[model samples]
Target: MSLVRVAVIGIGNMGAAHARTLVAGEVPGAELVAVCDVRQEMESWVSSNLPASVTYWQDAEQMMSSGTIDAVIIATPHYDHPEKAIQAFRDGLHVMIEKPAGVYTKQVRKMNEAAAASGKVFSMMYNQRTNPLYIKLRDLIASGELGEIRRTNWIITNWYRSQSYYDSGGWRATWAGEGGGVLINQDPHQLDLWQWTIGMMPVRMRAFCSFGKYRNIEVEDDVTAYVEYENGATGVFVTTTGEAPGTNRFEVNGDRGKIVIEDGQLTFWRLREPEPEFNQRFTGGFGQPECWKCEVPISGVETGHPGLIRNWIDAILNGTPLIAPGEEGIHGLTLSNAMLLSTWTDNWVDLPIDEDLFYEHLQQRIASSNTKKDKAGSSSQPADLSQTFK
Candidate 1:
């Protein structure tokens, strides 16, 4: 296909922004053929904003079957991501799904299988992968400049959401609607980046999650998770959507050096020798390895949503490699699921968790969920998503 005709499903906050980006010709090889949303307001918005050539459909199935699009961008709620992607793949369309994959692995695994079977370009909206700072960090670790990773810590608490934000949509922070809270919603990018840069998934996870600690929602708003890797490396992930003037510091210590990313800066402490080699050769008992602190220089601005979408379109049209393949979304989701499962079971959940048990617990939460009633009373409005990208 010379040009990949695209349709965006679920014209909510993120979806509407995506539609606008495509309509503005932000992605060179992509065309906004159609947009879909069940909300009545979106049809009016389309009439006011989009060109006549860009069609709007209230039903997604009709738009997909109308043969107007070769690809679909699934930006619906958390639960609909995998389901819609699966359907799109079945209909022989490329798919770019939003984060967290699904609330649980069982369903997402099926979606991944469908994508593989369809042999279509499947990608995820992991825009953080496009950040030059993170790209450099991943390169540093992969090149062995940082040696063997010893520890990892990320304190990302800046995802502050007001009660009005939650009240904007019934599915904003509910078990039955959006699945979980901060972990599923705000921490997907960090969780994806954490494992992506470190190049490993924790074999065991012990987490403590506080449900509705600072919010009126049923899902968790605060969490602290500890994990251990197969190589004996440990990691601590702490996050909350409550604190103001919040922190976004990610630190990783390795045998040869340490790297920290905070306040849009990347700092690296270079060791003269690897710690293992230094310890073996040192005679002085009260000494540490010589270290030089350097500010790592990074070029290129973060492309964010547009970059990922462009990459997806390029992959579809030019057979280029995807920056964030949809299948790998399972890794970060596994982390989130392990954390929630650990809290739910009050125990350390191992990697390759018991999906059946996790599903059971999640189903119990959904059975008693209060948000289903409030879904009808939804008063969702357009949100300024620019601030939420970080």
Candidate 2:
């Protein structure tokens, strides 16, 4: 197909943003044929905001079977993502799902299996992967310029949200609705980037999660997770939606060099010799590897969501590779699930987590979840998406 006809499911914040991008014709060779959402009220919004030729459907199945689109962007809730993407793949359509894949790995695994069997292009909306800074960082580590990794640290606490934000949506922060708070919602990109850049998943993780720590919600709002990689390298991940004037600092220390990314800048420290080799050969008791601090040059536009959409379209139309494959999403979800599971069980959780145990525990939390009632005429302020790109 020369042009990809696309439909967007879920007219919520992120979904609506995708629709707008498509309607604006920002993605080359992509046509916005239809938009779907379970909410009937969304029809009017879609009609008014989108082009006149775009169709609106209250049922996703109807739109999927309409034969008007070659692909569908599933931007629905965390739980609905797998089911909808699976259906799209079954229907022989390319699928691009929003982040977090799903709340549990069991279902996401099934979705990935379906995508594999269908032989369709499957992608995830990990827009942060398109950032030049992260791309450079990943390249550096993968190239072994940093030698053997010794430590990794990320203090990403800038995802501040208010009580009203939670109160705006009935399903905002509940275990049954949104699964988890910052980890599942705001920090999925970071979590994905964390493992993606390192090119390794932790073998085990121990986390302390604070539920309802900063808001009147039921899911975790703050977390501190300690992880150990297969090669005996250790790392710490800390995130929270409770801190303002927050920090977003990521550091990777290795035997030969170190890389730090913060405030949209990447700084690299290259050592003249490997730390291990220096330690063994140096005669002085207190000597360190000679280092040269260099400001890494990152030259590329920050594409964010629109860039991902374009890439997904190109992947389907021209056999281009996807930046974030649908199957790779499981790694990040595994880490998030492991963290929550560790907090719930008060122990360290192993990688490739026990899917059955995690699902059972998640089901229990959903069964006992207490959803908050939305106030009359109260809604979450339109997210200032400008600040969310990083």
Candidate 3:
């Protein structure tokens, strides 16, 4: 294919944004041939917003079999992500799924397996990976310039949401619908980056998750999780939609030095000598390894969602490598699931989590969930996506 023909499977906030980007010719090598949404209200949205040449479908299966597109961008609900992607892979179409992969790992595992068997390009919309700041951090750690990672801590509570935000989407913030809370929704990017930058996953996690703490919802609105990695590294991930004037700070401390990312700037406190060596050789009492505060320069605009979409399209058309492989998406979800599982079991949860146990717990929640589907409306608020990316 000279140009990858792409169809968006959900016309929700994020999906609509993707469609608009494709229609505006932003992603050079891709074409938005069709947009699909189950909501009847979206028919008018398609007519008023998108080009007349672009087709609209209420059914995704029909769109997949119609052969009008070579790939699909699945932006449906969390539960629908894996199911739709698996079907798309079977139909021999490349797939791009939105974040968090899926609500649970068991279903997502099957989706990954199907993707592997189909030999189709599968990518995740981990737009944050395209940010230059995160890219530099990952490089610094991978290149061993920072030495072995010793600790990771991220306090990303700036994803504050109003009660109306939860009330806007019926499927949101409910066990039977969206499955989880801030961890699954607003914190996926950070959760993904926490491990991606350090190139490691925690061996175990113990989390405290507050359900309906801030919002009038059935799911968790606050959380504080502590984790330990296999290499003796420790981490703390704290997030909530409850606090106002919140903070977004990420710190990674290694043997050589430490790096901090906050206020849209990256700063590194470089040690003159390795801490271990400095500690061993220092004779003076209360001495430190002389540190120099350096501002790590980060240049280039973040490509965000469009950039990831472009990467997926390029990989499909020209055999280019994907920036955010769909398979690695499980790593972030694993962390989130472990956090929930830890809270559910009231104990520490190990890595490579018990998928069956998690599924069983999730089913119990779903069965007991009093969450009403379509509680408000299917459409999301008019998103000022610019405010959301940081």
TM-score of each: 0.95, 0.95, 0.95
- The sequence of per-residue lDDT tens digits that candidate 1 reaches over residues 1-390 is 689999988766788788889999999999998888777677777778788888988777777778779999987777878888888998899999878788899889999999999999999999999999999999999999999999999999999988887876676688988788999989999999999998999999999999999989999999999999999999999999999979999999999989999998999999999999999988996999999998677988999999999999999989999999999999999999999999999999999899999999999998888775222112133534553332
Better of 1 and 3 by lDDT: 1
Tens-digit lDDT track of model 2 for 70-157: 9999877778888899889878899999888988999999999999999999999999999999999999999999998989999999
lDDT of each: 0.88, 0.87, 0.87
Compared with the true structure, what per-residue lDDT tens digits does model 3 show for residues 1-390? 788899988776788888899999989788999988777778888888889989988888888989889999988777788889988998899999988799899999999999999999999999999989999999989998789899999999998899987876566788987888999888889999998999999999999999999989989999999999999999999999999999999999999999999998888998988999999988998889999898777878899998999889889889999999999899999999999999999999999999999999999999877664332123232333443321
Question: Which window of 10 residues has the lowest lDDT sum in candidate 3?
Answer: 374-383
**For model 3, which pairs clash?**
none
State model 2's lDDT: 0.87
